[model samples]
Target: MNLNFDFTEKRVIITAFFCMAFTIANLITVKVINIGFLGMETPAGVLIYPLVYILTNVIADVYGEKIAQRTIILGLCVDILFVFMTTLILFLPSPAYYTGDSSLAFVFTQTPRILVASYISYLIGNFVNARITAKVNEGKEYSSTKNLGILAFSELIDNFVFIGLAFVGVFAVTDILIMIVSHWILSLIWSAIAQPFTKMTVKWAEKGKPAEA
Candidate 1:
């Protein structure tokens, strides 16, 4: 059997690894930070969430939809594993000398509702982003603007589902709506700002591609 250690394939694998890490981290610490001003509040994860979309777009653009979907699934599996491991640890007794169990639990213990919401929202958002990028750029040169537009819309749906499902009964309706809108807008803006970097990464991945010859 022949093996190919192609640079582009390695790039895709590395990007997918980061995507999985980011996805798990985003889910766990999403509720950790609360930024509020003028009567509006949102999770701190919004700052890094856009990167997942950007990476997904790059994968789809450089590789294909099949690879992008595989990455998403791998991420989802890792996220689930993270949740299980954390939950298991929370159930075990902490060391007698360790006084940070409370703090650890505060950060690691996720409610079932939030867990479900996160998984559903993440799968939907990532798959949609991949699909849109694949379809938009199919047999055509990649366009950052088009990718950003599709990502923005996908983020909107992602925010709506996650926020609505996670906080519907916990927060007031108005606050929930505000969070959805704010998160969606922030994610879109972040993606737009990161467009240059995204493009650069895609270009880097596509470099030295045998198929382009």
Candidate 2:
């Protein structure tokens, strides 16, 4: 299989950071946080996971779709490794001196069903996001509205797929629906707040060249 290895220090740094962020988000996703708006609760991952999309858009804009897609695939591999290592740690017996074993297992024990849901949703959502971002920007000037729209739509798909698959039997249908809506809305808000930083990063990546769609 042919793969692109084109690299600069900055691109490598950004891709590595993206993978770290992805793994961290996955590890923390089991923790729910209250947003204090309408008493809504969402996975803590929502706060940081949108950065994956934001950075993907930056990559697609600057390096093209192939590189962006490659980055996503690399993130998947890293996430798999993270899961494996964590599971290994969880499966091994803890020494008598270790007091945090129970807490660690509680935090890291994700059902295989949820893991499947996460991987499927991540691949589908991220690829959709990269494709739309790349397609919209082809031979055109950068448009923030369009970028945000792509983010909104992709985030919606991601929230729906993950929540629906992971919680179908564990939660009431209404509750699952609420989770999807709440997570999507919160993710969009977070992405909007991060837009300025994203734009600045894209501009820097462009290095004096105008950004294209």
Candidate 3:
């Protein structure tokens, strides 16, 4: 596929990717991965989930906060639709020969508590990230580190709310807190490691075009 070089097309592409990532993350949250070195475990979805925030920040830098917020709202709607369709399919009757129904249900089923946690955390975390990133860039030029504080603060909120809601009473409070802190740190590390590349892309996209207010 040919890449679009136009700024407007780039913004659209990024927004599309943001929505896709959100949906994919939710779908994969059923799998857990062990972190041998840390003697900890986490959902496999955590690995790519951080990219959603990074892409949001990049969109905020390139297109502006209003666009970022709208894009996030769009993503939220897409996620809702995804959940609805998957749940419907999971409950639908399957043909006698269809042996994959169990696998589909296994991969797609999510408790109502988890669904709430996912939606709440996603909206709160992403909007805060976009708002802070935009506020920091007001009357100033974009920089890779400009929104570092936003990432840390908002990501912590994301993990805390998600864990507190989904796993509270299931895990000890101390263990829950540890999970939050560990996830937050890992997310920050992922974003920080991607900074240089993010900076380059933003710089290229912002050429001859000032970010919207």
- lDDT (Cα) of model 2: 0.87
Mind giving the per-residue lDDT tens digits that candidate 2 earns over 1-213?
644333465688789889988888898998999889898999899879999988888888788899899999999999998889988998898789989988988988888998899888888888999999999997676777889999999889988898899989999999999999999998999998888788877767666342342
Most accurate candidate by lDDT: 2
Any runs in candidate 1 off by more than 4 Å, and if so which? 1-5, 27-37
Estimate, for each residue in 73-152, the C-alpha lDDT of model 3 and write its tens digit.
99999999998998899888888988998888899889999989988999899999998888887667777766677788
Name the candidate, 1 or 2, with the larger lDDT value. Answer: 2
Q: Estimate candidate 1's alpha-carbon lDDT, on a 0 to 1 scale.
A: 0.79
Residue-level lDDT for 60 in candidate 2: 88
Alpha carbon deviation, residue 35, candidate 1 (Å): 4.2
Estimate TM-scores for all models.
0.88, 0.91, 0.93
Cα lDDT tens digits for candidate 1, 90-130: 88887799888788788887778987887789889889988
Give the per-residue Cα lDDT of candidate 3 at 22: 95
Task: Return the clash pairs for model 2, or none.
Answer: 137-213
Distance from true location, Cα of 56 in model 1, Å? 0.9
Q: Which stretches of candidate 3 lie over 4 Å from their true place?
A: 1-4, 208-213
TM-score of 2: 0.91
> In model 2, what is the error at residue 91, expressed in angstroms?
2.3
How many pairs of residues collide in each model? 0, 1, 0
